[model samples]
Target: MATLILVRHGRSTANTSGVLAGRTPGVLLDERGAAQAAELPARLAGLPIAAAVSSPLERCRETLRPLLDARPGLALHTDERISECDYGDWSGRKLAELTEDPLMEVVQQHPSAAAFPGGESMPAMQRRAVEAVREWNARVEAEHGPDAVFVMCSHGDIIKSVVADALGMHLDLFQRISVEPCSLTAIRYTRLRPFLMRLGETGDFGSLAPRPAKESGADDGRAVVGGGAGAP
Candidate 1:
């Protein structure tokens, strides 16, 4: 089995301002976001991370900068599949204003059936995000062996969607999952099935170290899904 760590990017200027941001260019991480990013290397200090994959968006990239700096030898890659959702007409809108829109109701209660006015559907977003993780999981296992661990830096909604798929929960119910900025979620992929080790863990990880190598057949475990509010 291989371990996959999904990290939501640190807070952005848009996030602090309560803006949707959605694929908009020039949106960088706010000062608080920078502080959050700076804390990652320490949170992940002892893990044997083989690679660091990130969304192509600037915020995601900026969020990953410190980690890369701490581990210069670790390889880094960018994948568009993990980028922020294309919010279409809703892009850059305040969440408070969108609350009055009828679509907002569907997004909160039944995301699987919801589609942005002129943007991508929730189902489509989940499909691509899940597929991207699966591909990376296989690649990491092949190149770094079954015990390899890696990180994926992405957005709030996308992380929630991926978490939903990992737990085999309906996309509509993904609203129950919450992923805060710079939070950490982990999943272990095995031939039998995926095992979710943690979700939305926002504490200091300085004490959390990598597990020792295990013998075969020790991969099976109970599936646990952590819960919270809907995506940002």
Candidate 2:
């Protein structure tokens, strides 16, 4: 099996606008997002990336652009399975307004039962994304080698779901995991089990230092419908 470098696409216009942007066609990276994309080359400088895959969405593609430019020889492929969760009628709607929807609570705490009125279920989303990774892992190993490392640029929820699968967590619990825009998560797969090498690495160790705890909040457990705007 190969090492997987899971990347959440850089922050996008929708991200900052508080829209869900689920499978939205025209959502592109914002200014800070472009800067984050530009940093990809240096972020994984030493790894011999074997292959690259991205969600068939503009934001994900734009996020991988700088890295692909730096590695001209690495071919980039698009997989729809790893695209953002189909938010159905919720697509393009503001997250704040969605908070009032009854289904939002199910999405926050028991995502396994949450399904968009016109979209896919959370479990289905996880299954497809995990399947794509499995197929890619075998393909990379056959074409490159077991020790090969590959990168896949995808949406925040998709990346979080993949990480949850890698850690043997249920889809309902996936929302507890978060990956900031342009964050990198690494996983190593073997015949026995997958190892999570890193989770949400933004190259900011200062963020790891102890911080004062705030008062318990009402929305503390709510997962941002779309990954919320990254650290500001």
Candidate 3:
């Protein structure tokens, strides 16, 4: 029952503008973002966090800082392997505003074969992130029992990809789960199989309170998040 607590970073400046922000540096959380970070620590009040691993990005580090402040014993480590997929030239571009291109259409239809014009492919991102998570779990299981809890803080897209991999999801329908600024997702591991106990939800963080989601076009966490967007 080792608990793996996955977190998406707080609201970033890029998030406010809907930019790609792939592997970009210096994207700190907005004023609201800092507030969100301060609120999440209460969510893990008494749990033994064991280790606080981040995606080696500034925003991810910012997200984990509060948790570390509350729980002094929790070790903080960085792993580039868990960072967000490189959006390449798409970095900083609004997905909604991107020109309609044939390759974009191809990837929308054939995910494994599609690649962002200047970024990593979905399959590639998935492959490495999955491995990083697997290794993180192994270390925790080795030291703490399999029932121990391990915390990971990362980007929305990366967290979404990792969640999908653990639950067997696909490319599209990613919005099914809104990895809100400073949100948490829980997954349990038995032997080698991963079982999701929770998706993106504001459960309990130390001092952080999740921001309210938009009214319309919000994700339902019913599809594309795990077990594929359309899986039953």
Candidate 4:
């Protein structure tokens, strides 16, 4: 088995704008996100990342650019399954606006049953994402050896779903997990079960501080359709 490192793409324009970028076109990383991506190589200095995979979106590609430059020989492959959920008609809408949509409640409390108006269901998204990771895990292990580690740059929702599958948590509870922009989540897979070695290592301890009740519960149990803007 191989270790899988999941890297959510750096914050994007849509993130800062409070919109669900989904698979929307032209949503590239914002200035802060570009800086975050630039710092990735130094952050992952010692890992022997065997293979690199990314969502086809521009932001994911941009996030991996610096890392790829540092390891010029590492091949970069794009996997649509790891792309942001096909938000379809909801793609470019503001999150605040969507909060009023009736579907928002289902997405927050019962994601396994939520389906986007014109896009894919939450369950469908999880299935494809989990399958992609499982397939890639075997491929990397077979080709590179048991100790090999591979990285995949994907989206917030996609990463959460993969993490849930790895943790054996039900999809309905996946919203409880959060991975900030450019955060690294590592999972080691074995014959029997997978172990989550690291979860959302952004190297920032600010999140550990207690949050004010108002700010914390306002969005409690809600899955930020697209990962919300990370730290101020």
Who wins the TM-score comparison? 4
Task: Estimate every model's Cα lDDT from 0 to 1.
Answer: 0.80, 0.89, 0.70, 0.90
Identify the candidate with maximal lDDT. Answer: 4
lDDT per residue, candidate 4, 18-44, as tens digits?
A: 889898889999998999999999998
Candidates ranked by TM-score: 4, 2, 1, 3
Each model's TM-score?
A: 0.87, 0.94, 0.82, 0.95
Ranking by lDDT: 4, 2, 1, 3
lDDT of 2 by residue, 1-232 (tens): 7999999999899988888999878999999999999999999999999999999999999999999999999889999999999999999998878989999999989999999999999899989999999999999999999999999999888889899999999888888887889999999999999999999999865434544432111245577877776665
The deviation in Å at residue 6 for candidate 3 is: 0.6
Q: Write the per-residue lDDT of candidate 3 for residues 129-202, one digit (tens) a residue.
A: 87988898988889887668888987766777778777777755444545666778988877767898887776
Cα RMSDs, all models? 9.8, 2.6, 5.8, 1.7
The TM-score obtained by model 2 is 0.94
TM-score of candidate 4 on Cα atoms, chains taken together: 0.95
lDDT of 1 by residue, 1-232 (tens): 7899999888788876667888889999888789889999999989999989999999889988999999989878999999888788888887657767888778877788888888888789889999999999999999999999999999888998998888889987887776777889999998988988999787854323444322110123211111111122
